[model samples]
Target: MSEPESENGAVHEAQWREVRYEYTPRLADILAHLRATIVVTTYQAGKLLVLGVHDGKLQISFLSFEQPMGVAVGSDRIAIGTRRQIHFLRAAHETAPHVEPHGMYDGCFVPRTSFYTGAIHGHDLAFGRDGLWVVNTLFSCLCTLHEAYSFVPRWRPRFVSQLIDEDRCHLNGLAMQDGRPKFVTVMAEADEAGGWRPNKATTGCVLDVDTNEVVVRGLCMPHSPRLRGDDLWVLNSGYGSIGKVDRAAGRYESVETMPGYTRGLAFAGQFAFVGISKIRETSVFGGVPIAEDRANLRCGIGVVDLVSGQTVAVFQFLSGVEEIFAVDVIPGMLCPLIAGASVDKQERDVWIVPQPGSGE
Candidate 1:
């Protein structure tokens, strides 16, 4: 077991694990009384909550609908963009808007009828130096980064570029380097059009954002990538592994594996946090994800030491909730959370999500 240095010598984050319920608000003297925290992400059933750690609490933002696949995070206010609707919300743990019971919760910032006027799919979003980049992954494939305050036609959205006609895989994960784009996908230019299947074990490439061209291929279902020093540390979901890419050598190596389908990787200080979906029902040594397997692999948040390559802490899912999409550890706060999944909406675990001053 991984051990962390604490006030008491070697304490593990596991000492504070519980079901995702509303029983306790903060940490209790005893570990057993803690309730798991699951923030209401706004992706599909609400998207995954994307967190950027700050002072003592996590600043959470998520996406919704189809086009606005990004959320705006502010110091005291936050906004989530849906297809044509955007909800500018006050920060949470329980902050509410000045509306009535329903409207009391920060409501829509933009209406749904205003976005996706034609046929555009927003794949990724990032905070630009003075704007935001909303990527459209298919059809007339394009990457457009816009000014943050340029929310109207007067400023105009800047078009990065389109992929080569032969590069057919969806441009899903994107990052900005020095005010430009760096993107990754499941296939590349030399790839056959329909070869971008999730089940197959394939490694495509990472696009050089400046020229919007394919630079690296042969990635194993890579998801979250962070540009560290001279390497790109990426969470490769296909092998349940975290890897680093030699930017100059163009090689991939498996760092470690948690033995499940993994995605959403984030770094806090010296630790790496990864989100693993339900334990692959029944994965066969790198085959596609199996469908009917009903086994849950204690999914939650896993914390590892980047330097030593050891998993020191884990916060498990509870109260029938089975999966977490992402975890963001804000500074100061002992427990950090971003987005998680309820059993389902029919039996929703609303308590997992938090606002500025909410009790329920």
Candidate 2:
């Protein structure tokens, strides 16, 4: 019941939680055959979803963040993993307006930089070669962003030794690769404290950051590992599946199963969007298997078909969103928009010249 959203007329700046987004005209013909634009973060509806397409309809844009979990999409930049900060969004594209069959720019995306690092349960966000790599999950570790210190830990899951806040091993999910920090998804390699709250279903695994090992154990509550091209995609979220780890036969390969409780993951060519959720009866969603026969829980997005693993398209959400924690993919964006900050036309325009002709 919150839904505010306004920009050029600038009054209400952000409020979202009245979601109701549905898709499946083959998910708008697969976002008009991959012209792309599907951002989504929803850390339990603190919201930040874009999901575009213009004239033929289906827009759905919203911003307001606080719990907005992990999402990283660079090129024009966007980092977002809020709940203690790490905003950093850009991409105004010279004031945006050029529209028409692909001049493309209904896009806005505004925050320009935040990076606080307090709550520590930060979860995924990756840019690497050493820059914005946070998954600090209450210090199970993989941090970076300390120009004054709050984080800078780097990597830790060699069975998590120190730097404590005791989320022990709920170390969410992260996977970078060439830019570094290669793989991670935990729910239980348990060091203590919440000890992954009684193995949230199956003692999930998938560690392997250069053989620190645990290359895929009996996962069920995995989250997003994604590193496609030589494969390493994960999202076994308490058994709603979407696997693919095998790092030289350590085992994980499921690749498709979605009706709820999968966690966000993204990728475009050959597909794989994943991110389902909604099993809420709590005690951390009871005995898994997508909460067994609870009439098949379901929240949204499950495109999958990384070469025939199935689920061709879906976008369901039949109500004001419930869960969905990160799903990037904005390649060739179609109709993006953000403008928030109570928008006085994106903050009454500012100026800071010096890089088009330069000797200013």
Candidate 3:
């Protein structure tokens, strides 16, 4: 049989796609209660969106980047994985005199540095014991960035034979448990080049890092595995739901079935923030349940109550944008932004690192 066609198949290479978005009035009320800012990456649209509520209205700020996918936010920094690089950014003071209409905060994420990792199909990113660990999908392995080299191979799914350009298993998501890489999601355990393409609609599984076993299976294109407390939460993308995995029972139970192709997963307090992408008629998403249902297809973020499993609020994108790869929450940051490389060189150089003599 002929090999299944890649979902991306020459669609974006020839041109650029535009993105436009709008959030509902309810989004402001929901964000006000949480008092946290959200960072979402849309690889398809090549943009990073920061969401917050300011001045009794919803603040949606965006920064342009090339195929921005994985996002991880720390107390003082934010990490974003793009097509060929990983960016490290610092928060622009939560409270400052320059705080503008965006909110009490300036909402700027000044680019501290970036790693040129090449095109490794960098997916989920997390700051682990070995520094910045990334899901290097192209090599079917997890890797960490190094100042002297491209990447340092961390671990690979047991089924993968050798590191190659082929995205054999399509390892896409990473989860950290107890400050270590715990579990990962893969489309399939195919050890051949482009082997995972045929199983895009099925054969998805979650691998437990400690035991190196497929803890859960029979998923439809899953992504974004996150460990919250003791629960392993994941976005079953093809099913358009955010759920938890029961390793002992081998059950994947749904906490909430969101609209669109659910992918990004982040949490704040008791609420779960999920990113949903408008399902395009591609080989990867065409026949999925989200596309079949048709009634609820939307591209935006869904805020759900973890305990009640109800969608509390939504920030919808009416047009221009259609896909999201990752989502992150900036805890305690009401308004935040990333200055990026576009900022003035002099302004970007404005930092205070004490010299040895200054200490005297």
Q: Which of the numbered candidates is closest to the native, going by highest TM-score?
A: 3
All candidates' lDDT scores? Answer: 0.43, 0.75, 0.79
**Per-residue C-alpha lDDT of model 3 across residues 135-217, encoded as one tens digit per residue:** 99999998888889899998998889898989998999999986789999998879999787786777899999888899899
Regions of model 3 farther than 4 Å from truth? 1-19, 92-95, 99-103, 106-108, 294-296, 342-360
| Error of model 1, residue 156, in angstroms | 18
Backbone-clash count (model 1)? 27
lDDT of 1 by residue, 7-125 (tens): 11111112242234211111121111221222222233344433322232323333233323444333333334455444344334332233223332222222211322223344444
How many steric clashes does model 2 contain? 2
How well does candidate 3 match the true structure in TM-score terms?
0.87
lDDT of 2: 0.75
Ranking by lDDT: 3, 2, 1
Ten contiguous residues minimizing lDDT sum, candidate 2: 1-10
TM-score of each: 0.57, 0.36, 0.87
The deviation in Å at residue 106 for candidate 3 is: 5.9
Q: Candidate 3 lDDT (Cα, whole model)?
A: 0.79
